[model samples]
Target: MCIIFFHFNPNSASAYRLILAANRDEFYSRPSKPADFWANNGNILSGLDMEKGREGGTWLGISKKGKCAALTNYLQPVINMDALGRGYLVPNFLTQDMDGLTYLKKISLEGHLYNGFNLLTVDFSNTKGDMMCYYGNRSDQEPRVLDPGIYGLCNSLLDTPWKKLVNGKKLFTETIKKSCALSPENLTQELLNMLNNEEYQLPVTDIEEQGQDFIRPILEEFSALFIRTSFYGTRTNTVILVDAKGHVTFTERCLLKPDTNQWKVSSYQFELET
Candidate 1:
């Protein structure tokens, strides 16, 4: 949602990997983690509250069934609803092992009576591998199969104009390019370098859009402010995938937290050796 990080082809043994960390005041009102969570979901999974019988704030989730998904709220005010439309997506993804596209089709056809929201679903269960983001509103923009590079998508449409999304993406892209130019051997470190670069150091901004001043209270809650100054927006999200040998890794960091430098909140390391 606010912060999204990933690597398309990192030249590793894993096929794909992703880690998601997000912050939201809305999660407080929702339910907590699921009971017998391991039985239904994978060994690694995370989520917040929002569903009818479930909670929200799903930073990241990975199922033993090989299904994975991470959720974040986009920073937009015009797309408001009583509840995030189909807010139950995260829990459903964790508990149910359905094909990604099949699931998306059903949700798209069935309308919702709640607030509008966006979702990124990853399905690697079969050869039909893909990643998708949805806007539960009039926008018919279907999910996008993520490319093999560093990408950031907040709430304002994929590849928006927000400083973090825009600038972050630039740094992320250049980091990878420069690394490739040096030598392909630094693939791992190169990928990490992109996620760990310091040149992206710029004080956060309280970026206000065309006509959302009145909604400052809501916007301020999730906009990017310097980690040292605020915790309203996405700190950082990193993902890496290598298909040649079937290995993957992903990590997300809470940049606002002063006490921790360990980023990979939710991660998966495995080989789909079928």
Candidate 2:
């Protein structure tokens, strides 16, 4: 499962803020267009072109309106055919005008035929921005809303408190609650702290703790031998921020190669007319 955290603050230049950190075994598939999967003429928007038959997943992106979104895959037991590809949700949220509840209800009915996945979409373009969560039917409940601040979202549930996303939550909470002042520059520093933290250590103490405990076991079990696979490991850690003014910044980290320590950072900043 992957993890996503976002901040919604209307007073800042960018009405919304977002940070996405995800850990996957690797992606070994072809590429596809956002529209080929679904159409999102809505408020939020984001997409990644699948490299022909090579598949890739996106963290999240914003739209011309004041919307933002992210998604994660569920790694639980289920029929293979039951899983629904969520490549369309990001772009849908970015481009669609549908608010939280409206989109939830519509997607619920549309997803009845599919299996596992989760999407978190937020729109602050209205008088007050709102947030919502959508899960495959087996989650035992209906879609729900999220509060403003840092949150941990994984495949299992909202704020799953898993290893990869826990430390980020802690840092974000402290920055907002304890800092005397906050700004885009400070937020970017906090993000870098998480990415540069010991990549080889355990993320948490135990299953009950809000961190990762099975670090050793997972590495031992999976890194037994080196094999050639057309997979992209941890490509980049992205950080996005949208203050009240509709300004946004996107930063990405490009790793050297598999099992390497070097990395490169690239950033993009833009503003919307909202």
lDDT of each: 0.46, 0.52
TM-score of 2: 0.70
Clashes of 2: 35
Estimate the TM-score of every prediction: 0.62, 0.70
Candidate 2: segments with Cα more than 4 A from true spot: 10-25, 28-57, 77-83, 126-138, 178-183, 196-232, 259-262
Over the stretch 183-249, how does candidate 2's per-residue lDDT look in tens digits? 7667676765554444332423432232234223343222211112335334445667665565666
- Which numbered prediction scores highest in TM-score against the true structure? 2
Please write out the lDDT profile of model 1 over residues 126-190, one tens digit for every residue: 35444443333334665445554455655545555676556557655665555434432344445
For each candidate in turn, give its C-alpha RMSD to the true structure in angstroms: 5.9, 6.0
